[model samples]
Target: MKKLLFLLLFFPSLIYAQNKTGGINWISWDEVEAKMEKEPRKVMVDVYTDWCGPCKMMNNTTFSDPQVVQYINENYYAIKFNAEGSGEVTFRGTTYKNETYDANKAGRNGTHDLTRAIAPVNGRIAYPTIVYMDEDFGILSPVQGFYKPEQIMPILTFFAENVYKDKTWEEYTKAP
Candidate 1:
């Protein structure tokens, strides 16, 4: 009983701390917009819904790793975006809103206009979508589902190194 009580108290705090570890640099949409107007860097958006299991997994696993955080912080401006929130977002001269969402309900929320405009052409719109973009806000890739730190390292590195500039992922991965 004593052990159970101790775990109940300490475990949650540990989990919370672990969840906040990774990602080198984090900024708000407003900051990203303002910076882009002056100097542009690539952006990474973790587009997730509050109730998504995989999204939570990302918070618990990938983001918690210090190495992962360090890499991201150095390379990109990371943004955590809720797909169903009452926030006004402006990207590339267009404004997006959560006009159709009623967050009070279960499993039903209006997607932002920005999400609609930038939906992946492959049509794999799932929970825990991580969108990568160039400095110009051009969509680079949309990775869906849960990915651990190991799984995401290459993708993260790919964007960081600007391999997308001269070659595709297939071409880049094929060499060496």
Candidate 2:
């Protein structure tokens, strides 16, 4: 009975402890451009809003997974960007702002100009948007939805392995 009680109490913490999970290296957006300039690794930006439930879930579940974290941290310069933030960013000689940021409205969020400039089709501009880019910061894909760790594993690995160089997702997935 005592062992069972202890296990139940600590299990949650064990799941969340940030230790050697998959290659996820959480970082701020400001660091991404500089890091890319310095080393030029692939980049994966997690564009999220504070009130989005799925965004929170990814942080506590998918991102917390050891395999996901390890792979992301190893191959991509992972960044977390708050879509509705007033954080200053310089992009192509222009500045962007939320200007009218509202803290409410069914959890809908705003974004800076930089977000608009970098987002892919659908303009991302959505909660929990995952933007994948190549080493040169060229946009690859924008996944604007919730996904489990397993669901994202292949997508992440596909980009990391340079599979995009020769085959499409459909072709690669079908090729053994």
| Candidate with the greatest lDDT versus the true structure | 1
Query: When superposed on Cα atoms, how far off is each prediction in RMSD?
Result: 3.9, 3.1
Q: How accurate is candidate 1 locally (lDDT)?
A: 0.81
Residues 27-134 of candidate 1: C-alpha lDDT, one tens digit per residue: 888898887888788889988888888898887779878778878877788998888777888877778898887757787478877676665547656778889999
Give the worst 10-residue stretch by lDDT in candidate 1: 17-26
lDDT of 2 by residue, 72-164 (tens): 888899988787776776544566677666656555555666667666465336668888989877789887878899998999988988998
The residue-level lDDT of candidate 1 at 16 comes to: 72
- Candidate 1, after superposition: displacement of residue 148 in Å? 0.9
Native-to-model Cα distance after best TM-score fit, residue 25 in candidate 1, in Å: 3.4
Which whole-number lDDT from 0 to 100 does residue 169 have in model 2?
90
